[model samples]
Target chain A: MAIRKEKFTMIKVAAQNNIKADKIDEFIAIAKNLVAETRKYDAGCVRYELLQDVKNPQLLTMLEEWDDQEALNNHLLSQHFKDAMATFAGYLEKPGEINLYKTLA
Target chain B: MAIRKEKFTMIKVAAQNNIKADKIDEFIAIAKNLVAETRKYDAGCVRYELLQDVKNPQLLTMLEEWDDQEALNNHLLSQHFKDAMATFAGYLEKPGEINLYKTLA
Candidate 1:
């Protein structure tokens, strides 16, 4: 059967104290490229997009959808994801908030 | 004092278990218009925009910015806000999740 719907994942990161603007740029750039790779490689994943806070632009939100939870879990553990986390660790101002869920309706 | 920056508020709604597609459209339409009004009338609010889930398209997220917390509270209690809530009550599948924040760096 065809997939009915995908879940939306909301991820947020708060800037750490005294971080520089230039570093924020570097982090975001790396994130964009890395996330693109995950989307391309994960066939079960439906779509991924990033949104920036309108006023507090430093806050980044990612929207993702997958065929099902299993597909999502697998994608999370993929090599590209692990490598990206290792590389991007230093740029974060703080640990990120991540919430994943399937569509309710 | 000149306004420095605004806080970002993120809001989400889950679809009611048996909600239909057309009602989602109605709820979103009303929301989009009502939100536009709030942005135009509330000077302390810097910006507001809505984004939909990339995979689960029915889910929506609203991004808002305000001059400060007080401004945000005032906006929440505004006449338009109450009216919108009253008008849109029937469309909700569940209570919306609302999170407010300020920029760190």
Candidate 2:
């Protein structure tokens, strides 16, 4: 049996970052600002929100939904994204893991 | 600075599973039915959808949002959820990882 590819156009992103324990507050502050700007200005951004692990506060995940690949690509190049990345660099315990997905159900 | 805890009522869940290559189709079929049932009948299930990793076909993640912890807990005890789990047991490569989260932004 083959995996069906219908309705796979929308892109969902899960960007997981391990922030330094002391920097959680700072990271979230910047992330909240980025979320606001992306939602307000980015086209085809269906959802963009940050989530903190219930058991581990240092583990932060950005749950995002984009209309398509083009919208996601645009978000990567947007000024707000770059700005947040710059600040996020110093706050992260290690490099973040970004995984892109397509809706299957 | 302290991490503010306002607006943390919503519960988000990310359940990641690795399906056997041969069982991917079977797993997805069951999952799609599970998604439909959960969305249509499960109360307080804001979002319950399956996502396939763009890079790894075997990796399937269920991205879910619930109204609160009580709703999420109720979902665990749901008959549909148990029924799906029984079929999912043999198809999985390993035990699935389920993480609960709170929206931070």
| Residue range B16-36, candidate 2, lDDT tens digits | 999999999998999999999
Best by lDDT: 2
How far is B59's C-alpha from truth in model 1 (Å)?
1.2
RMSD of each: 10.2, 5.7
Model 1, global lDDT = 0.58
Best by TM-score: 2
Candidate 1 lDDT by residue in tens digits, A63-104: 565666667778779988788678666655666655444321
lDDT of 1 by residue, B1-68 (tens): 89976545433221122223457677667777767898788768775655554344455556565666
A22-105 per-residue lDDT for model 2 (tens digits): 999999999999999999999999999999999999999999999999999999999999999998999999887788999988
TM-score, one value per model = 0.47, 0.89
Each candidate structure's count of clashing pairs:
2, 0
What's the CA error at residue B15 for candidate 1, in Å? 14
